[model samples]
Target: MKNIILTLALLIPFSGFAQEFPNLKSTRQDEDYSFLKNDTINKNWYKTMKFLPINESKSAYFSFGGDIRFQYFYAKNENWGNGDQDKDGYVLSRYLFHSDLHVGKYFRAFVQLQSSVVGGRIDPSPVDANPLEVHQAFADFNFINEKSKKLILRAGRQELSYGSQRLVALRDGPNNRQSFDGLKLMTGKENMSADFFFTHYVAARDGIFDDKSNQDRQFWGSYFVLNKVPLLKNIDVYYLGYKRAKANFDDATGKEIRHSMGTRIWGKSGNWRYDGEAVYQFGDVAEKNISAWTTSINGGYRFNSIKFHPEIGFKTELIRGDKTKDDSKLQTFNPLFPRGAYFGLASVIGPSNLIDIHPSISFEITKNIDWIIDYDMFWRYSGNDGIYAPNTSLIYPGNTTTKKKIGNQLETEIVWEPNPFLYFRLEATWFQAKDYIKASGMGKNIFFTGITTQIRF
Candidate 1:
């Protein structure tokens, strides 16, 4: 009650904001405001903050931008009442500011600072609180910069993402997004590109100035994307490598080394869009041979002739699980650095050792306002393997009971974006516990509601 009203009150007027006009990018580092340089007549009011001439140099300039987000969550029986019950709900606030300095066409530096805090929550997780810290600090050295192609070397702390954010993502759904400490080589053209990097994941500490790269884990990968090719356009292929000193799974916990090779293909035509991805993982864990895989299909169709222009969307995923608990082989597909909200706004479950079917419909209520309704069903891909959390944390181990059905979830959201810089969303979810959840231990259903507002500038 009061939380809902207070959440609505946080939607302040923030016309003075972040992202560039029209093509507002999710990743701030990718924003390009060079077109503002020619607007001598001050066509856009944001030019004062986005385009600043450095010592009157043609190639040297500085751009400043920031964004603040407020999120409130009201959940009953969180995680099926498994852990951390807070009937009073919780609120989260995140502030991110960044500066981009370009010395010339060949060199530049980007730095971003982040502060995230929580209120009215009992025993917050490490990801929930970060008083203040550096989120991204990197330098780009462009070896070849042209209108059609680019070759650059980037170093330092940064964010990495790939097609659809199924595997590698920025993890912006949570208060504290993910970052990496590494060096990357980027080369690409207008229609295609490739990224290669070797780095370590940053461990988020609760306090300020204490976050650092994890010493026990190492990540390396190569991702390539091709678009506008003949017959087979819009394709992504990648090979990812991971190593951790200690990895936890239902079967065992030990040092793990895994490698994943995958590809994705997607396109749209005549109000219809589709995407499909497949992955194969092979590695060794605790001297046991590892084999795992996951595949997904997503498609949507829009009714262009309808009054509301509604779109019907569907997604299905099949992630493999451990075959047997007593085998010398381990098979648990890992969702490496996936998006925080992999399946809509209610992200309680992750994409590991699970089978899911999701269907959704979204329609525009009015100008800049939209509404969405979705439902999802889940079951254990392998009854021998238990379910997992969004961060790949084991929730339950395999039990003697053969019930594999986890539950069903229904969710809805209303999104209102009156302007380019300010946005608001209200969402609710109902998760009904099933026999499998009851067989494990608890069978309490879960109810979750959230309100979110963002001011980007």
Candidate 2:
């Protein structure tokens, strides 16, 4: 499937050129670079930095860009379990290589590769898997007029990032990143823009082999944006719609196949910014009819170098119905839908799949450095509950009659962004849930820390 998709993507650009389509945006003025525009063509700084010819008469034009990254981490109590005899101190390392090639105005290609080391082992076992794989491999065709004015068409595997939090991200390819395999159509002029996309499955990992399921899953979504409203300058209104089919082998067994639909409204107004989202899901899980809903509101205030953002989010199951009578208590709530995938952290920590409220604040110390502190409070209702386990394969024998109803967690992080292409992030989390870990006799308090670096081009 990967080979076939790659072949088709590569062929599309050639077909566009064969049809006599001219290279777009090759001669357009980039107002953002005023220095280059003011200087003489021969003495332009950008012209001196350019290693390739700038003449349109040249047979070929090529642009080169890529990044390499390295990361290391330290953990106080890596194992969030009992103070037992287990290796809890070790140095983790990861490396990433990414590159992009743009040829004239007809073709563009991207490639990403990653490798990792755990506990001094180069190629660790599955339990220590660090996702060493290819993140993206695709070609693009620009089918828009040279003058930036109207409609545009982009096809093949691509990234579609819209709205504030990237909830309906089609191109979130790979397990770690995210990407979509399909087509995207975009059109806009002035301040209004509209986009449409269709994809197959949400690739969660890097390599083609690390895809969630072997069978191709169907997915489609669309987004519309209106920017710079008259009274709401610097503000944008967005709407999104998406539907996906489960790709697991047991999907036929109704093991929580997801049918999700959601929308969001967000933008910035001076020192204050806000975003809100709502979603609904309907499906059958494990022969039981399932329906659920979720909503969230996030707002922030910026003061000098400090920004405080407090968000409240919630999820509920409206149709537990008669299914609860026959199935085990644990089978009531579907594990597929968590609070929200944001900030690269698990939103809530508890069972019942019920409710969560998170509040966070961040401070910037320097131009390229910042810190974030957040807390998440989780509440689970009776019937069924959920918890995070390091290894899902293990089953624990425990009674939930005495389970705690509230789980409190604290998370802090320091982020350093030296440039657009490179970033270093360090994070630590502490949580307490009496019944969080069923196997561990003591689930009172758990702490863990991780550090990572990323480079993109």
Candidate 3:
């Protein structure tokens, strides 16, 4: 424990002087600090550590950085009081350190180490603990590097996040983030970009360095994005393929193979912003024809003239569900890999076989502080199908109950950023059980409160 404390101390910044530093990316691998290569502009206290020219060559260099995050959750009536609940709460701590080495721009190497821990919990899941492990280790080779266009090939283990992260994500909100072992080819220009990737997701383990890729599960996808569309500011199109040897759903458990095609359009004009996405899926589940789909649209209007500059937003989603468990065709939508906070910080529910309407409002209380509140109402798309967890696993069985109303939730969060290197957040959630929850299982309301502190250097 002492060693862990000592390591986290390194992530604290003595001064908030990172304003001029390279902007941090969601996945650190995409960050570029090459501009610091020039000696004339490299005159910051931390510049020396950020950019280290190898033997004065300047062409080849090294950069080092990391972050420390600690989160605590106090959940009441977990799973609507159906599951075990800790009396007090649980704590999740994560540490990440990385090094980037550039070999003459054409070739580059990156490595990251991770340690996540969970404490005071009734049951610890695999993702809640991984004492220590290699989070990401990858190499990149640039096939074409030019002013107008560029292409790069990357291999080994890495984190993949794209679009709105409804389908594929890094699981950033979880204690132990997800990583994939595979290869990716990326090509892009000023107005367009695309990625082709093939990989197997690594399974999380509680033990140290025991994580490995799941051989029975494979994922491959191609994603394309076009910027500055005529009516829309941006457009994204993607095709994803997934295969799992043994998959379990609300109905029978068996092998599954699925393909998804999706399109997204997003843009902002004046004080109005909109984001819309639609997806269609087709495949085979135990040799049975599979068909499912989902559509989501969100719009927000910023009240710039109002106090605190509040932005009112509304979002709606409809995810297909199987009409019956013993049906000839499976219609349950699969959310491949999605964020943990699909609904709110409680995140008890997932995006499958359901419909949700969310209305929210956010305020910029100050230059460094923000607050948001949202309400979501959920209903099962098909009463014959059950509700799922954030990981797309069945949680509440249909039990032949035909009730459609599941529940409603109210959530609020506040974030404070004193500087560029540190931030603190607080969140609370309440979910009210409805007819379905009462008839199927525990009908208790779920309450959750969370506090998080993150430090980056």
Q: Which candidate is the best by TM-score?
A: 3
lDDT of 2 at 105: 61
Candidate 2 lDDT, 276-295, residue by residue in tens: 66655565545554455555
Residue 279: error of model 3 in Å?
Answer: 0.6
State the lDDT of candidate 1 residue by residue for 1-457, as single tens digits: 3543553455443344433366456689998877776778745546767878786654788888888888989999887888768988889898899999888789989999999889998887766788898999999999997889999999999999988888889888888888999999999989999999999999999878888999888999999999997776689999999998898888868998999999999999789999999999999889677899999999999998898999999999999999899788889988988988886556777899889999999998897899999999999999999888777788777774688998999999999987777788999999998878888767799899998988777
Q: Write the number of the candidate with greater lDDT, choosing between 1 and 3.
A: 3
Lowest lDDT block of 10, candidate 1: 11-20
The residue-by-residue lDDT of candidate 3 on 289-355, one tens digit each, is 8899999999999999988999999999999988767867889899998887778768888999999
RMSD of each: 2.4, 10.1, 2.0
State the TM-score for model 1: 0.95
Tell me the number of clashing residue pairs for each predicted model: 3, 14, 0
- Higher-TM-score candidate of 2 and 3: 3
Q: Give the TM-score (vs. native) of candidate 2.
A: 0.66
Q: What's the C-alpha lDDT at position 251 in model 3?
A: 75
Using lDDT as the measure, the top candidate is 3
